[model samples]
Target: MTALHELTAEAAIRAIEAGETSSLELVDAALERVTSDPWHAFLAVDEDGARERARAIDANGERPPLAGIPVAIKDALSTRDLTTTAGSRILEGFRPVYTATCVERLERAGGIIVGKTNMDEFAMGSSTENSAYGPTRNPWALDRVPGGSSGGAAACVAARQVPLSLGSDTGGSIRQPAALCGCVGIKPTYGAVSRSGLIAFASSLDQVGPLARTVRDAALTLQAIVGRDPLDTTSLEWREPIELPAGERLDGLRVGIISELNGEGIEASVRGAVDSAAATVESLGGAVEQVSLPSVEHSLSTYYLIAPAECSANLARFDGIRYGRAAEGADSLLEHYERTRDEGFGSEVKRRIMLGTFALASGYYDAYYLRAQKVRTLVVEDFARAFERVDVLMSPTSPTTAFPLGERTDDPLSMYLSDVCTIPMSLAGLPALSIPCGFADGLPIGLQLAGPAYSENRLLGVAHALEQALALDQAPPEPA
Candidate 1:
């Protein structure tokens, strides 16, 4: 018999509906594993609350799709009554009065919130090292990092502490970690999911997504949380609910390989895995061809400028005046602001904030920020043109497998390059997913699939077909 903690969310729901398992049993099993978490995947655990909710659901005999499923939520999302830190010291110990819309919807659908997972402070870094609390180690290799800023969410699923989790992707936070951790993660089209209660980090780029052990589990999680919310003005309105495709064959599908992503900089092993995935897609009766998105070359540079600029403006709210930690014994208001921020934010957060402030400064504004926006437009146009030629695009999620922790902490450029293949799709506000394709020296390599806006159903369906055909074993080795 399989451990209850290792069951996928979809399977757990089935067990509950069949009367073979109770909600309390699942929550208890998950909580036990969480308590013994050696990777530091969780920041806080809500044992009492989770127990109460489980007991109520078991008593009511109403099993929703995720009725008894236990899920780990990224700390970036606000949870009422639970501290929502965004993994920063400044907002430490602060609880939101209202839960984030995505989280609320998940609970309403009967998913149990097991606890909050750790992340990079304000979702800034590619590796989980930027987290103020501490770094989250990859379950496969304890010395290596679980990619971030959604490292905790990915780690929990890969470690089997829970089969489903929620993560936020802004320039590859969710997908990169999923690839490194050997799980499935999806970043939905921007505005397809509400961002009302999520702590802002590059507001235009941040979108809530799901990370799970399987493709079907990820799709079901997305179905439960995606919808328009009145609180978020950017949320998209849709009359029909999104549905996962029931079919597995890609008889007439067209797949595109971005030319710019294949050349130099990508590791040989990573490239080889992508080629294999493309071959699998072709074998599934789909047409595969090379396509160009020239402006994608400038994605890293443009993303650094635009994302930091927006992060600088959005993070200005945490000046100790509103909520969060305030400095004690400040002689004047100016001193108070300086001390509060200096103590609250981590080194990486401070660096980006300074870079953003400099970019948006009076004389440099037109030269840096405005120019980056123009290049962003070109990148978006590049994707639009490529999509006209092909139905979907595929690439390596990262240039390499998980690297040793602290390997690139001093080399910020190397860390930024980790997200190179992922940022272009984010800039275009498209739906993208990362699925385990193969392994390199015992580490998993991810194959990323991306499509035009609001094309999640087709994207996931194609990925599911590839997943079935490749039949790669994604289980991580026992934690060290």
Candidate 2:
């Protein structure tokens, strides 16, 4: 019998249903893995809660789709059992009274909440080094970084600490780290998954998605998470599930290769990996065409302005009184807020808060924030127009693979550029995914596939086809 730790969520459910494994055994295995290198991924481990949930499920013999399977919820999401720090000192002991809607959904699907994973402070940085708790080392190469702000979540899944994990991607948080760690990650359409309990970095851009080891696993997790939520007004209800045809040959699939994603600023090895994957798609009967998203040039600038503006607003609620750390010697409420926030927020978080505050300020709102919003519309329209020509869009998940920790941290501009390829889609609120394509310098690389809004099923299908052809048996980096 396969050990519970080695099984996928789908496989775990089947095994439990078939009486092949007990929920306790699976939960214990996950707990053991988490305990083995607690620093690498988790911020908190709800061992007692997890075991109790597992025992309850085992007794009922009611295995929801992922019954008894362990899942690592990104620290950005609130959980009553665990501290929901956004990887910052400001939220060190902050635990929400209510669980996130997605967390509730995972429970309904029979998933055991293993723990909360670390991240870049408030999901601001590209590397997990920004985490107030310290960087999450790549499971593959201990010296290198696990990409962020979903780095810990991806690391947990890739390292086999859990079969599946949740991440909130404002930029490439989910996909980039998954690629770096040789795991599968999907950023569902914006608003496809509720953001009710997620710590807001960029409210309009942030989205919750899954990271797993396989396309099927990612799809399974997506199915469990996707749905409308009354709590989140942004959430939408699709009439039906986005189910791509299984075993469907990629022959004749219309794939658009974004010309802009290639050349200039792309690493030769990364380019080669993308080319090889594209060729694999061609061999499998998929036609790759050179399509352009002209507005992509403005994506970064628009994102910088828009994201910070929202971040400033959403984060204002963290004024030290209701949550996290508090500053001393404040006679006034405003003074208390300033002192608490100043003390609680990390440098990166402060940087964003200031930039966002400035952008939304009365004098600059028209020039910066409003202009960015207009450009956002254009960015979205660009994809809408491109999707008219192709079923899916392709790009490299990042310009480069996982860099050494702190390689780009000092240079915030360069670090922000790491998410260049991803923010455009997020601005457009479209579904995109990053799958492990190949390796460069023994480090894993990822190829991105995006689709129209609410086209997660189609994107997953396309990703599945590519995964089949690539036959990438990407193993997680051994823990240091």
Candidate 3:
């Protein structure tokens, strides 16, 4: 018998349809893995609900695309029945009145929600340490930090606790974590996936996507989630579902390496890993060229400004007036709001909030926030121009591999640099994926491939070809 935990969603569906295994068997196996070992990946386990859903799917015989397959939803996305804490105390007992459209789409495609995975508080930090609950350790090496704010989501999939998981990428949150954890993450073009029920970090940049062990699984999950939604006006209008290339190769494809993304910022091992991945593509008859995006040098600064500005506005909704946690003993309404937010939000979140608030404040809005938005446009245009010359852009997902849990927590500027390579893509609203290409020391490294807007299918196709050539998705080292 096949180990139920090892089966991918597609494989599990095929097995269930063939009567080779029952949904209950798969669900029970997944529940066992999650319960016996405390991966610390999940914040809330919907064991009873998931089992009930599994039993229903088994009996009804109406299989969705991922019928009987278990998956984890990031805590950042709202679930009507599950607590939607974005790894913060502010929303500790919060449950959304309605489920996120992406979560609903997953259910429609026959995927079961196993649990709500943990994340950085309000999806602000690069490490899960910002999580009020506690940090999620890297599955490959428990001593290292799993990349965040999607760390729990990536760790869950990497550890095989869940074959598939969801993550929200604001600045490299999903892809970076996926790379570090030895999994695959797809951050679809901004607005490609609905952001309606996603707890906002930076409204314009935050995109919910899939984290899985294989490019196919990520593509399959993306196919289920990408489409226009009335709930989110900015959502992408992908009328036709994405159809991945069944067996694609890199022959004759043009791949661009962002020259700026390499060199000083990246570690030697990470640069080597990317160089190896590029060679793999070349061996498969793909043409690789060095491309330059001058505006990329300022992307980190621009992102910090734009993202925080938007975050300040988006987060203002949670002023203890109506939403989330409220201060218990405040005599005045103003005092209640101030105390609630000051007490509820973590230090990092508060820092960003203050920075963002200052940027958007009356005197500075034009000089800071508006100026950053203009810079954002230039960054997007640079990518657009580059795409005209190449089919896809490639880079190391992060400058370095997984670091020790508290390594850069004290130095905010150093932490910001981790997402430097990823922010440009988010700014441009391009689809990007990170697949395990190699490892540095004992930690995994991911090679990032990005395509133009609404090009998830093509991006995944390219990544799929690279995945086959590199075959770096091998068994990860046991946790320390």
Candidate 4:
């Protein structure tokens, strides 16, 4: 028999509704896996609260859709009384009095929060190694990284500690990690999910989404959290009902293979998988063709500029005096601020802050930040033009399969390049997702699917069609 902890979230929910399993049993099973974890995927586990919440759900006369499902939340989001460190010591032990609107929405829809997962400090790094709590190991290969800044959220799902997890995506944080971990992850159309209480990495770029073992499971979690939230003015009302279509027929669909994302640096194996996937799309009655978005060539350069600039500004508030913990024994006010930030933030967070400050400085703003913004406009135009010709786009989610931990920790440029393929869509505030297509060197490779703004319904429908046609079993292997 499969362990309760191994079941997909959708399966668990069905079991609970059928009285085949209870919420308490599922929560306890999930908690057991989390507590015995070797992957360091979680920052805090709310054992008592989770059990209490599960019991209440089990006792309810009319169970809700996700009544018994256990879901992990990334540590970056405010969780009311739950500790939300944002994977940094700067705000250690800080619990918000208010919950992020999306998290509240999840609870309201009957999903139980099992714990807060680990992440890159302030969501700055490309790998979980930057996490103040230590790196989250990939379940497929213990020595490899699960990708990051949402590494823990992806690892937790890939390792089967829980079937679904909430994670924030900023410059590929969610999709890259999900790809490396061999699970499904989504970066909702920006504003599709409110960012109200999510600690900012880059306010303009950050968006909350889900990582799950299956597409439908992810859709369910997404449906629960997405909608208009007055607290976030950028949020858009999702007036259309979210429906996950079933099966392998994508007849009359248009599929564009992004030439830039697919060419150059992408590993041969990853590229081959994508090519095979394109052929499969063709077989599904979809028109498959290569489409070039030339401005995407500058994606890495523009992302580094815009993301860091926004991060520098958004992170200014964590001065320790107002939020986070201040270091002891500082005589001068400036010294206090310096010591607090130096002691609280990780190297990557500080690195980006400095880079951003340099970019936005008095004399160089136009040369760097302004040019990047202009280039960003070009990128948006490129996508807009391409979408006019194609309904959806495809590529390898990451250029390479999961690399060993510490491989690029000291090489920031190499780490930054990891997001090259996923960042363009993020900059455009579009919806995209990564799903397991095939394996290379015994590790999972992700095939990314993206669509125009507010096109999640079409994107997901196409992804589901491919998911069914490919029929790859996404569950990660047990640790050797």
Candidate 5:
């Protein structure tokens, strides 16, 4: 018999509704996994609160869609009264009085918050090693990294600690980690999910998304959290809940293989897996063809500029006077800001902050930030043209599978390259999903499917079809 903790969110919900298991049983099982967490996946676990919520649900005879389902929230999402460090020492031990809009919705939908998962500091790094608390290990290989900045959220789900998790994607934070961690992760269309209360990484690029074990599970979670929020001006207006289409047929689907995402940098094994996935799509009666998006090649440069610039502006509020770490004996205000930031931020965070400040500085703003924005428009145009020709686009989520934790730590450039394939869609503000396609060297590889903005339904439908046809079992081996 499968343990309660191993069940997917959908299955757990069904079991709870059928009275086969109580919410307390599922919460206790999840708590046990949290206690035994070998990957440092959780930053804090709300054992007592989780139990109390479980008991309330059990007593009330409530059968909400996600009633009693254990969920791991990435530490960046503010949970009222729960510490939200955003994996930075600066905000360490600080608890928000108000809950993030998405998290509050999840709780209202009956998803029990098990704990706050780890992440890259301020959602900056491609690897979770930049986390102030420490890095989250990939469940597939103890020494390997589960990609970031949503690494902890991905790691928790991969390790079976929780059936569902919420992660913020700023330049592929959610999907990249999902690929490396061997699970399904989705970054909904920009503005599809409200950003209110989610700690900002890049205001325009950051979006809250779901990482789950299956496409249907991800869809269900998205349905519960997605909608208009007056608190977020960027939030889109959509009255109907997102529904996953039934069946695996892609009879009229036109799948476009990203021409630039393949070749040179991608590993042969990773390419093979993507090739297999494409074939699977073709087998499902879908038309597959190669499509070019030239501006995609410039995405990395454009993203580094725009993302860091926004991060610099957004992170300015954490100068110690307001909240977070404060310098103890600073005689001057300037000295206070300097000392507090110096002590609070990690090396990667500082690097990006400096880069952003430099880019946005008067002398160089036009040459750097403005040019990047113009190029961003071109990238968006590229996607628009491609969508006119193809129904959806596909590629390997990352050039390779999970790499050793310390493998690229010293080389930030190499670390940034890991997100090259996923960043372009982010620049275009399109909806994309990453699902396990196959494995290479016993580690999972991800196949990414992206579509035009507000086309999550089509993207998920095609991905679900490929998922069923490929039938790749992504269960990571038991943690060592």
Candidate 6:
């Protein structure tokens, strides 16, 4: 029998509805696995609460779509009564009074909250090393990083601790980590998922999505949490709820390879796999061609400026006065504020905050932040032009495969380049996903598939086809 922990959320749902597995049985298995993981994928494991939720589901006569399935929420999202640190010590013991809308819906759909996953503090770094709790190691290569911001969410899914988990993407936080960790990650169109109660990173760029071991599982988790919510002004009514497709071929579909994201800076094996994915699309009767998004060359720079500027404004609320952690023994109130923040935020978070503050400062606003915003629009335009020529676009999710932990921690520029391929799609607020494509030296590589805004159904269908063709046996090694 397949271990309950190994079953996909879709399969778990089927079993629960068919009277084959009890929610308590599955929840117990997930808790055992999560608590045992050495990868530090989770920051908190609500073992008792999860078992209680599962028991209640078992007693119910009806089964929800995700009934009995355990899910890990990214630490960045607020879970009422659950520690919601956003992976920073600044908010150490704080818990939100209300859960994030997406999370509220997730529970309403019958998913059990297993734990809160770790992430880069304030979602500012690329390697997950910026996490105040310590970096989440890549499941494939324990010595390497598991990609950042959403690292813990991806790692747990990749480690098979949970069938699905939530992750917030700000400049590839979700997709990049999914690539490194060999799991499937979906970054929905910007407004597709409600952000209310989520710990803000970069409000405009951050989006909540799901990480799963399979395309179908990811789609299932994504649909439950999406739709317009009154709490979030930026939320949009989805075109339609996401429906999973099981077809194995992408016949007559048009897939474009983003020229800029493919060539320079990308690792050889990753590039080969992307080329291979395109060929597989052709074999499935889909047309493949190269399309250019010339403006993406500036994606990295534009992202650093825009994301940080937003972070500065959104994070200002964390000042010593209101909540979380505060400093004492300062000679003055201003000194107190400085001391609190300096002691609270991690180095990377501080760096971005400084950059953002400077960019928004009186003398530099026009030269930096405003210019970055204008450049951001150009990136959006770039995608719009390319999408007109192709129904979907393909690229390497990251420039390289998982690198040794701490390899780029001291070199921030090198770390930022890790998201070079995935950042452009985020800037455009388009739906994109990273599916495990192949491997390099046994390390997983991921191929990114993206589409126009609100085309998640199309992108998911196409990725499902590619995933079938690849048929990678990507399970990570057991903890020793």
Give the TM-score of each candidate.
0.98, 0.97, 0.98, 0.99, 0.99, 0.99
What C-alpha lDDT do the candidate models reach, one value each? 0.91, 0.87, 0.89, 0.91, 0.92, 0.91
What is the total number of backbone clashes in candidate 6? 0
Q: Which pairs clash in model 1?
A: none
Clashing pairs in 3: none
Q: Model 2, 1-480: lDDT tens per residue?
A: 766787877788788778888889999999999978644788888999999998998899665778888889999999985788889898888878999999899889988998999899999988898999889988777888989889999888878889999998998899888888888899998889999998888888899999998889888888888889999999989667956336647877888888888878888888899888888888888898889988888898999998888898988888877667899999999999989988888888889889999999989999999999999999888898998889989989989998988788888899998888888989998899999999887888999999988788778888888788778855564544
Candidate 4 deviant stretches above 4 angstroms:
none
Over 1-480, each residue of candidate 4 has an lDDT whose tens digit, in order, gives 468998888888877777789989999999999998888999999999999999998887566667778999999999989998999898889988899999999998888899999999988877899998899999889999999999999999999999899999999999999999989999999999999999998988899999998899999888898889999999998988777757678789999999998878999999999999999999999999899999999989999999999999998888878767899999998999899989998889899999999999999999999999999999999999999999999999999999999999989999999999999999999999999999998899999999998888888898888888888865667765
lDDT of 1 at 130: 94
lDDT, model 6: 0.91
Q: Give me the displacement of residue 335 in model 6, in angstroms.
A: 1.5
What does the lDDT come to for candidate 2? 0.87
Q: Model 5's lDDT to the true fold?
A: 0.92
Specify the highest-lDDT model's number. Answer: 5
Which window of ten consecutive residues has the lowest lDDT sum in model 6?
60-69
The model with the greater TM-score, 3 or 4, is 4
Candidate 2 segments whose C-alpha is farther than 4 A from its true place: none
- What lDDT score is found at residue 413 in candidate 1? 90
- Model 5 alpha-carbon miss at residue 208, Å: 0.3
Give the range where candidate 4 is weakest over 10 consecutive residues by summed lDDT.
Answer: 471-480
State the lDDT of candidate 1 residue by residue for 76-131, as single tens digits. Answer: 99999898899999999999999999999889889999999999999998889999
lDDT (Cα, tens digit) per residue for candidate 5, span 1-480: 578988998888888887799899999999999988998999999999999999999999867778889999999999999889999999989999899999988998999998999999999987799999999999999899999999999999999999999999989999999999889999999999999999998999999999999899999899889989999999999665699757789988899999999888999999999998988888888999999999999999999999999999999999887678887899999999999999999999999999999999999999999999999999999999999999999999999899998999899999999999999999999999999999999899999999998888888888788788888755788865
